[model samples]
Target chain A: MTENSDTLGATEKEIMYATHHAMVKSGYAELSISRISDELDKAKSTIYHYYDSKDALLLDFLRFSIDRFESTVNTTIGAHPKGDLDHIILTLLPCQLKKEKRQLHCVLVNIMPHALDQEAFREQFTEIDNRLKTIIEKTVRRGVRTNVFRDVDPAQAAEHILAVIKGAMCTRLTTNREAATARARTSLFSYIDSHLMA
Target chain B: MTENSDTLGATEKEIMYATHHAMVKSGYAELSISRISDELDKAKSTIYHYYDSKDALLLDFLRFSIDRFESTVNTTIGAHPKGDLDHIILTLLPCQLKKEKRQLHCVLVNIMPHALDQEAFREQFTEIDNRLKTIIEKTVRRGVRTNVFRDVDPAQAAEHILAVIKGAMCTRLTTNREAATARARTSLFSYIDSHLMA
Candidate 1:
């Protein structure tokens, strides 16, 4: 489990790209090698040559997405722990996502149910959840240590904040309601201002 | 639109029952009329007489689910506003769900992605989200009025609480992580105790 997209081969990169588009267009349940190859404008044999099945390809795509997400966080944020936390909250809100990223979010949301039945999918999703939780946990710990945030339980606070992020994202995605996310963002930042900031 | 399960006729009730079992077993994506009929142990024509297609059947099932959920909340809770709030939170937590109810939750999670592509599904899901939010909002308002809860923005508080409920459910369902929900439940109850209670 490497978090380096740079390590992927050229063909692997292409497959990931095609898989993204295919998932965005047809969703996870409808996604197939043929649909991915159609998106790639290449032979299905090309995808089959590298990956044995759709689930394998999807797992790779999930890893690729995680790598991209990590790189984005590392490069775009981290100026300050609080800023990083706020930026992550905004980024996770589905309303703030751009078209392509939103499609990616949609597909990830789509794949969540499959995780119920597929152990491989469940493991990868578990990793995804833990990785995100860990990131938030680290930031909270750093903030508390630096005295920028009030003395608080970093793990518990991180869980609460991540809950708001996940809840806002799910509300927006599942309901397609803009007001829900708006309210959640307001409530979360208010908590950070009142309870978290020193 | 009506939240009365009693309005359903005998065959409609039977169909809803069969649909519930079918969805619980096969899931929404794999669900078909044949599967539903198989669950009913009846001819395909019998189901077709009630539902024109799978989507129609699913739409009714969604309404049926909402009705059942509403009845459960109304009957099981409502002794007092604060107690109702706590009970709703406990009810929405997937970890607290029984086996059959957990299967129903899984199917609802499965339907969320399909709602993205299908407008009717999207509308029904929006209703589900709003209905839940509204229930919490009303409870919060009542609690505040009765002086059981601290003076707070009822709508905002409701949204935040609902976010925690949803976030906890999604975390449990997607990652199959017990620790996450346990932490979430602790964080949420702590928040309610410190922030909301009078």
Candidate 2:
């Protein structure tokens, strides 16, 4: 799917976009190609021609999201490469709490439980989670090595950080309570200030 | 549902048990009264005698779960009244990670997103969450007053604790990654020591 992005035309982009919104609304099992095509005013064959199946389309969608996340993380880290952990962490939280990301977060949250039943989805998610973990792990390790963070095990600390963020993100998406969302986000800063800061 | 436990007969208990398992397996929309009755080897009328519809059944199930959780929390806190945070927190984590609780946790995790679409479910969940938060809030306030914990906002700390536990629980329920579950569970203990310990 990523091999020929340049070759992906406007219609293909539109199909992917509509497919994403459809998945957000309906989830994987409930996803309807016809509904997406209806939304786009195109035939289902348009999406079928680009991606053979719903799973195939979603797989590419997940990859696209991961690629986007990786790039965003890199850019955020690049802007704060000198170990401003608060800014880096803040960058992660607010975007998710915003109204626009709620649907996407909801869809992904649904995928978590379904992963227990579906092998393909589980594999894709595991791969994505592992990649994300590695990114956080590298950042924590660099922080420790540079003495910006106190003595701490990088892997364990990374898991904690990931847990807070993922846990917070999932909670934010699941519970629409603005207070809980803000509390989760702020607690991350509280956690870093209390534990990791030098 | 909670009133007059003595008034609830064998059939009511049986229906509640069956409905709980059905919700765990199929979620809210897919739940069928006939299927639940079939599981109990009874007529659909038998369930309808107790519940007018599926929503009514599920709502009672939610209340039943909350009541059970509240009693369980009280019993646990009573046992650890002096701020034995490890025991109190440990009580929260292991049960969900166990094989028996996975399906129940899955049902709850799924409810989180369904609430995003259904306002009634959202209200029900928010009420349940608020009650649960209050329990933690009171416990933390007592802990602080007794000097068992450092100075921290009880509400904020409760939110953090809830996030870590809920986040950890959702992650544990969704993924069969023994490593991820183990890491998330391990991270919770690490969180309490770093944040709540005086």
Candidate 3:
């Protein structure tokens, strides 16, 4: 057993990234310290030196990954200053890396069951979810005020947008049908173009 | 340790219903044959007599529940001749049993992680999900044909509607906030009323 630390330094960040990559490769069910070490090319003992158990490492890893992911979204949102709403919506989408990889959002969803058991993860997830929705709410409100969008409640519009993304992602995750997923995604934007626009 | 039966009879349906009630009460994690037996006021042997184990019974119960639930939705759809689109959309909404009880849909979602392991459950769930979505697709197409809806692609529009419903249900499941859930649900209908209408 080792002492659990609250914050991650440079080395800790590397370890968390290793854990995430390992989780992405195999999934959270088979995630282990040994595997994380293998991914990072670190000895198992050295990896265990910073964390007491798999659970502790995973909890911290979830927090770290979520923080990093949120910051990236914030950066994307910030980059598009008064840009097209479609591009902003596109920025929030989960993407496939290649024939091999997917975005971290998909990986997080794969371990959703595990997160349900962690009180801290649930609280953090709720907050992160709300913040993400808030960004959309602001965007929608801005669109409405600028006469780009119809008179719609920003919060409800935000909720619907999130739902569309979630539902589309779930469809893709389950079916792995690119065409069907694309249709779902495209339909959302078209709905926005037709309905949400003033 | 025992033979797995292929079909369930009336008694078996009753037993499955008991298992569902028990699941709704204690959730999937705490669900057991003994708990189901207690719920039904039957001996454990009685349950074991029909099914080999909890997993087998649950698989069957999921199939049974899906069948029954689809029938109810189909019944609701059939009851509406020249039905309003809002009524059609309302037919697909998830329900709460009472102030204290939620419908079994939430229970199914609670066990979603477990379903990933079972190929039967995954297949059945996917098929059932597609069928439910198909109902919405047909409704949207009918609306478009009758000039009640905009000329939207039926499949894509269906996907968006299902996504909204799924996203809203997921929110309700996670937040348990009545106001937020209602807002999410209402937004979808309003979106249709405003955008889908010709």
Across all models, the iRMS values in order are 1.3, 2.1, 2.8
Query: Which candidate order results from sorting by TM-score in descending order?
Result: 1, 2, 3
What's the iRMSD of model 1? 1.3
Candidate that scores best on DockQ: 1
- Candidate 2 per-residue C-alpha lDDT over B1-198 given as tens digits, one digit per residue, 9 for 90 to 100: 224233558897788778777766676446789879866789999888888977777666666676666666656655343444555456667744554466666667656656666666666677666766787888878788877777779899888777766756655555545566567667767776667767
- Tens digits of per-residue lDDT for model 2, A1-198: 234234457887787678776765665446777878876788888788888887677666665666656666656554332344555566567744454465566667655655666666666666666666787777777777777777877777666776777766765555546678778778877777777777
| Top TM-score prediction, candidate number | 1
Q: Rank candidates, DockQ, best first.
A: 1, 2, 3
Candidate 1: lDDT of A179?
Answer: 88
Q: Local error of candidate 1 at A191, Å?
A: 1.9
TM-scores across all candidates?
0.91, 0.83, 0.79
Q: Write one digit per residue (lDDT tens) for candidate 1, span B66-107.
A: 878766655554658878887887778745667778788787
Model 3 Cα lDDT, one tens digit per residue, A61-152: 76776666555556544433235456545655534434223445555555554433455545555655676687778878888887878887
The CAPRI category of model 2 is: medium
**lDDT on C-alpha atoms for all candidate structures:** 0.81, 0.67, 0.66
